[model samples]
Target: MASVKPWSLVLVVFCIMSLSYFVNGAGSNEGLGASFIFGDSLVDAGNNNYLQTLSRANIPPNGIDFKASGGQPTGRYTNGRTIGDIVGEELGVPSYAVPYLAPNSTGKAILYGVNYASGGGGIMNATGRIFVNRLGLDIQIDYFNNTRKQFDKLLGPSKAKDYISKRSIFSITIGANDFLNNYLLPVLSVGARISESPDAFIDDMINHLRNQLTRLYQLDARKFVIGNVGPIGCIPYQKTLNQLNENECVDLANKLAMQYNRRLKELLSELNGKLQGAIVVHANVYDLVMELITNYTKYGFTTASKACCGNGGQFAGIIPCGPTSSLCKDREKHVFWDPYHPSEAANVIIARQLLSGSTKYISPVNLKQLRNL
Candidate 1:
């Protein structure tokens, strides 16, 4: 795998979202039952509510687009649910509640893990540097460790080991906002460029990420499903501000992401090799998302270029698309649910691909190899 053409992220020539191409979904949760997630908004389910940051979504218009239409207490970016929410239900669990930040009512509720992903978090502890209070990745893990300590006290070592060993599924989706908000934006004030070259920057970034995850593994986290970055350049938000000016993806950003994913595959393979019975998986969001952009006509998208809400401008991607802002007549016919996020309809399709296997991207072993472990 040399350099990935922005168009062909999946194995097929043009990586469109057919869902029909991969036939072996519904198998990822084969033995695993519950999920514990920690990252950023991509997998966040309301953890930011407890934190003090302006990057909050627990307001009006946020949940308006969801299937529950605000009935759901979920703080996901989507109108209704995220892939995490769907997968939780699929695993016969309730909403994957935010751990530590979200309170557990009973002693036995620790059976399934909770989500600790803050909206602006990253692999480094660099999230929310602009705001007063935010949990960086290291602190988030610290919170997770502390909570696990509590669970250990309550459940006792034997049952805690049982829960950790048997049905615990760990999902981590992060890194996009690390570049966007912390590094790219002019206002965050911390403009520390890891390096000038995209390749070097990504290597440094994900390498830093691997060390943190390795610490988690040593602490008893067994199963891991790491999400690959989506086509950040194609996002209406990025396309509006950065892409159109250059008339292409912010190649620096896109290239870094591609390199990150490419390197991530090799890193994950080696991790699986070193850690027996532990799994490392990738969700090729780059291809799943391109379907919403280039092949909009085929995917029933009426407007792939603009978000459904607000002016469809550079800022629209920042908030939810609803009454206070602009609203598309139909959502199923569109791709992005928000300027920064995907639709409920889109997530279901992406979830299908991830469950199939990590391959079509990862080289030697597919997800089946990890699951068999």
Candidate 2:
């Protein structure tokens, strides 16, 4: 071939790279092959429906705005999709992870992934005991362990291992119930065992969560995104329960969550350094939710201090949303769906941030980066 000019050679290389980028962008539908979800109600999807638990959302008014289910609850504890649902959709996953307890969550169905989260679940077994029946982190892990075996059988050991280890994103949203239902319960607080001290309780939480995360790593999950506890003190339920000013969140609850989050970030950093071939990204939800509450109008929400659907209390937070609960005329204008969960609109906002934001929003890396890696 004849010698090419330097500028011409550079232009040719640029065109080739541009073409490659376009091709990859077009084929991006392949997405992350699977999403294995763990944790509590924030990401439960519908696993709690199969259990005999009081912490259920498979009722009316709960899914009045979920167009996907003909405005019916899919057991998601919100007006529409949960954070897990939004994240899966944004990442271009073919479908939401099937609830581990669902009849369809077996054999070939598991090739996509499974959700082991439960409505009342927490990092500790005793965390949600008041609900009578709930899956603790240990039980959820056991379910995941079983699913791993099924994956091995379906795809054969080598293929299954490769798929899980390389093509999946494991997302967890836990710890809120550990504080809401256990540590800060007005009565029958299980956190009382630790003498109601933030230090002891948080230490217990960190220790259990570390083991829980390691178990997933051992099961060949290489990509992980774990959300930190949000501003628990600012939830409508917390505000109503504490009888704080309309514009004020529960101070002690907020303090506890901040303390735990500090340690959680440290723990994630340590795990990322020590775990082989693992990418753990921490989703910083406190600041995100706090922003929505303190400056609701900026996010197009009319009120972040009250819920869209609930009963009694200044914030309509005395009771969880039910058939008899009063609902706001505009669900999109409220950050909270009921007393404890974010509305679908709010979840969409948070999910987008977690997936695409920089280190300030999601430490180490965001979900998009994690998926590409």
Candidate 3:
């Protein structure tokens, strides 16, 4: 070929690289396969098999709504995808991986990130012990560490560590179970140790949660997408229990949720400030979910007041909405898939808002703007 001018060569390179980024949305990375997640049923793909918690979705009706599963839903609490899955969609990451419990698809640890997020887990010890097999936050971190070693064996420490710290997305979504399963269930605060002092309990739990998170930051985690607790008051099951209460969710629980969020915000701020070169982003599921609850009319959700599963009074919310279970004809019209979870369609809407370009809530700097940061 004839010698090309230097400016012409530079233009060619710029055009080619721009196509890879704008069209592909996949950025330069150390080869991050997926977003590794840890926490509760909010994001659990199939890791509850590792925990002894009653807060589980490894059952029928749970996965029946997941369209991506080809009409076979996994044990996700939502009808289709959790916030994590949709978040993965926004981040250009694959659906959160169940690397810890699922058998290797191709006998490789190179699948997207592993999800150790078991349903019913919490910051408190013995939180999800009701299940025969479960994993707490500590064990989840241990899983990440073990996976690091395994990947190191496959690709060596330098490459493996780079993949985690630079390329991979790290997300954590837990804590609702701490209040729902432990403190607020049965509509009574009796027999619950946390009930001894709910306020103190929240402070302690947030502190413990922060410690676990700080540990993750220490372990080569820099690009963090930390999820705050969603609205606990508006779950269909809870509403059923408090039907007489003028649409008011339990005050104590909601107060504590807000308190916990405040603490977590403070904690993340401190963390970002302390750690150099850290990109800590808080996914505010709190208001993102509450908007669906308060503004259901604006969103075209007909039955934000009722879950689409089962029958009868508040009892149906507790009962799983399955194949035999009563379901609304139009799922897109309902905000909640079951009592405590959002429908797949609702999740998509929330995901869209979260990734909306006008606001930068998911990250202090959205991925689109992260390059300058």
Q: Highest TM-score: which candidate?
A: 2
After best superposition, candidate 1 residue 26: deviation in angstroms? 20
- Each candidate structure's TM-score, on Cα atoms with residue i matched to residue i, is 0.81, 0.91, 0.83
The C-alpha RMSD in Å for every predicted model, in order, reads 13.8, 8.0, 5.9
User: What C-alpha lDDT, on a 0 to 100 scale, does residue 47 get in candidate 3?
Assistant: 68
Candidate 1 has its poorest 10 consecutive residues by lDDT at 18-27
lDDT of 3 by residue, 240-311 (tens): 776634255656667778888888888888888988877887778888888777888798877676787655
In candidate 2, list every pair of residues with a backbone clash.
none
Alpha-carbon lDDT of model 2: 0.86
- Choose 1 or 2, whichever is better by lDDT: 2
Clashes of 2: 0
* Whole-model lDDT, model 3: 0.70
Looking at model 3, residue 177 earns an lDDT score of 80
Report model 2's TM-score to 2 decimal places.
Answer: 0.91
Error of 1 at 304 (Å): 2.5
lDDT of 1 at 203: 70
TM-score-better candidate, 1 vs 3: 3
Q: How accurate is candidate 1 locally (lDDT)?
A: 0.65
Which digits, one per residue and each the tens of the lDDT, describe model 2 over residues 1-373?
Answer: 9988999989999898866533332223368778899989888878889999999999998888877789988888999988888888888776778999999997666656789999889998988989999998899999999999987777778878878888788988899889888888767884494565789889999999999899989999889898888999999998888787778988888888899999999999999998999989899999888877888899999888888999878998889999999989999999999999999889999999998988888978888888888
